[model samples]
Target: MIGFHFSNYDPRQSGKSKFDQLLDLFTQLLTYTSGDVTEALQWLNELDKKYELTDDEYGMGDFIDELKEKGYITDDEQRGEIKITPKTEQSIRKRSLEEIFGKLKKTKTGDHQTYKPGLGDEVSPDTRPFQFGDMLEQIDFTESIRNAQINHGLDSFTMQEDDLQIRETDFKSQTSTVLMIDISHSMILYGEDRITPAKKVAMALSELITTKYPKDTLDIVVFGNDAWPVEIKDLPYLQVGPYHTNTVAGLELAMDILRRRKNPNKQIFMITDGKPTCLKIGKRYYKNSFGLDRKVTSR
Candidate 1:
């Protein structure tokens, strides 16, 4: 058998400037703080103090000034806090998408389905003879000209409706999606840090849907001992709580949210690492962590 070869990547093996390193550190800290600029900055300072990452000439204060100049954050006198800009939030979402899914596939061969060629409302690959009731815009001018040339000699070329070609197409409308994430205490069991990856996936899905499918609407919700909706920007700050998995509550909330959406094309995605262990019954919460609770799982 041939030996396998693998290469290791050193992130710090670069010619990045001090400012670049500071920006990278800030971006990393943003995830833990949920795009909160002040919190991220404080964490960055603490990290810098611990690791001596910053030099005397280029310190954290200078980095903050650079961040303001770079349009990443802005100070609000009204709120008495610096907030991350929309551009920074978008950048965070994109980074999360890249971290989880890599880059978007450029071809038609992947888990993500690219548009297929069909005779529907949009453009289709297979074309047929021009039929009645087809719009003039649908006619393939180049193909029609070629057909005319084949039917009549170039010396006396003539075109007719019979020589026209129409394109086949398919139509798709808006879609509504509900993304459910599990934030139970088990997500970080034994310091595995499962919630961070789940949060990245949520951000990735939201960014992908909102960008690729502009007409589509996406709602994200997290479930633990309870379930509630969270904004896309809040994904970076998602953390596991001292609670058990409540898959039933998550599913119920997803269905309830989808039911209110006007779009007929609606779906739900549940990301979890364990089975249901808790659910709310009227005013009381039922908890079961010993093993797989059949009643909770059944729902």
Candidate 2:
């Protein structure tokens, strides 16, 4: 739980401070709840009473009304509930990702590669003989004029093969990568929680793939003793398990998921703090607390 501080202003107008107070309250609430404005306000009323709120003070109802008026939340009368607005949702996600991930690189993966001058793979932008539907701007004016004079006489003008110039497109393929994370107990060893940062990276990479490359694939995976996929909504509350690392299991699952894709270029990204210490054998468990088991490594 997070607490707030108030300046020693006159108590007569203390209710005015409710806006600032509510903002902090909501920020804290967002950490616990998934920015559920209505749910948070409902719980806030109890907190207000616990603090012995004054009658003149802005209550949860008033705060919720203001939130609607300000467009932070919207009330769906038919649904009889207040939900987060798109603006608020984006803000929360951006803030959370920034706080956890700090800054991350924009990754790209596609046929079109970003070209920089002097790079070894420098693509030739020179034009070739023009084809039908080629842009008129690409015409070699000098060559075209010379051809027109020689072919159709100087007074009459007509385009010919020598006048044509066609722009060339560069080609370079890249692999689309999907990163998987293991949210098992070892990640937060001795009370060092790592899930928050992991979630941030996933969100960052997802955003990067969608915005920067557009064609890239980024899938997030979290595994404990057993592995499974999850959505962005399932991230914040993700907790580590009292289970062993299952790196091979996670990789096998990832490979299975990526196999069906038609993309010739594809790869897997696995981030784990510890080695795979366990493997499922029949109905029993094979455990190796020792460092880097060969069988697990081979898998």
Candidate 3:
């Protein structure tokens, strides 16, 4: 017989090291600063001064050196500037993914299983009589053999088209998602800081699609007085602009992006804090922020 033993749990035994804790905080600050490495480090130092994030054994200087050694940041001597590397950008996305999705379990790629049965990689338990156009590989040999034995006898085994069993496979769909982000001044109004959360959600979703669902496509669009697409790598540096909301432009751009994608399933997700307040017509601007504008909303 097997036995089990249990021990007392200690919260202090958590696996994260001092550097990792600081790095997590630093990454979050970088998002708020729009990928400004110097500003993020300054904020970290301030937090350390107030909250005692580091001790004498492992100070902020040590963490900074570790960041350089790990290739997460690069310091240019000639230009007198410090910047985050692509590796750090990827790390921020991974952290955002984990924070929002809660550490997803590892699985095979393209695992979006659907109820509809068709040609797919994953086999389903449901089976049906073989159809005229069914492929030979889809036939369940075991069930077909059983059916043959039931139809005939063990003395002489024979199989017919009616005796064949076709196993159904779950259909996996690829999706083309257009994520529209509102960059109008309202996102940062009232000292609420709404754009940071929007940025995090975008980063998390982009990371999820790229890593877990490789076949899917994700396009990011930012809308203010106008709208345009941004690359996945530029998500960390997105900033809110001093412009009015032009949701129509964002939707039009999103639709244009989806039109170019070959995926069968398409969707649009918009993140905004205010209603439509601006519209453009033939080089002229129509703006109204008091309430919902009829012309803008109707458009």
The top-ranked prediction according to lDDT is 3
Which pairs clash in the backbone of model 1?
120-169, 120-170, 121-170, 121-171, 122-169, 122-170, 124-168
- Give per-residue CA lDDT, model 2, range 87-129, as digits (tens): 6655455555565555556764344454432222333466467
Q: Among all windows of ten consecutive residues in candidate 3, which has the lowest summed lDDT?
A: 8-17
Cα distance off (Å), candidate 3, residue 23 = 1.2
What's the lDDT of the predicted structure labeled candidate 3? Answer: 0.91
- Lowest-lDDT window of 10 residues in candidate 2? 114-123
Candidate 3: tens digits of C-alpha lDDT, residues 1-299: 68998897532265789998899999999999999999999999998898788888999999999999999999988989899999999988998988888866876655778889987988999999998999999999999999999999899999999899999999888889999999999999989999999999889988989998898889999999999999999999999889999999999999998999888799999999979999989898899999988888998
Candidate 3 segments whose C-alpha is farther than 4 A from its true place: 1-13, 77-79, 103-110, 130-137, 157-162
| RMSD after CA superposition, every candidate | 4.1, 8.6, 4.8
Encode model 1's per-residue lDDT on 139-180: one tens digit a residue. 888888999999986999999988998876655556899999
Q: What's the best-to-worst order under TM-score? A: 3, 1, 2
lDDT order of candidates, top first:
3, 1, 2
**lDDT by candidate, in order shown:** 0.82, 0.65, 0.91
- Candidate 2: misplaced stretches above 4 Å? 1-92, 96-124, 133-158, 171-176
Point out where model 1 deviates above 4 Å: 1-17, 35-39, 46-52, 74-85, 103-106, 109-123, 131-137, 149-155
With a 3 Å backbone cut-off (N, CA, C), the pairs that clash in candidate 2 are none
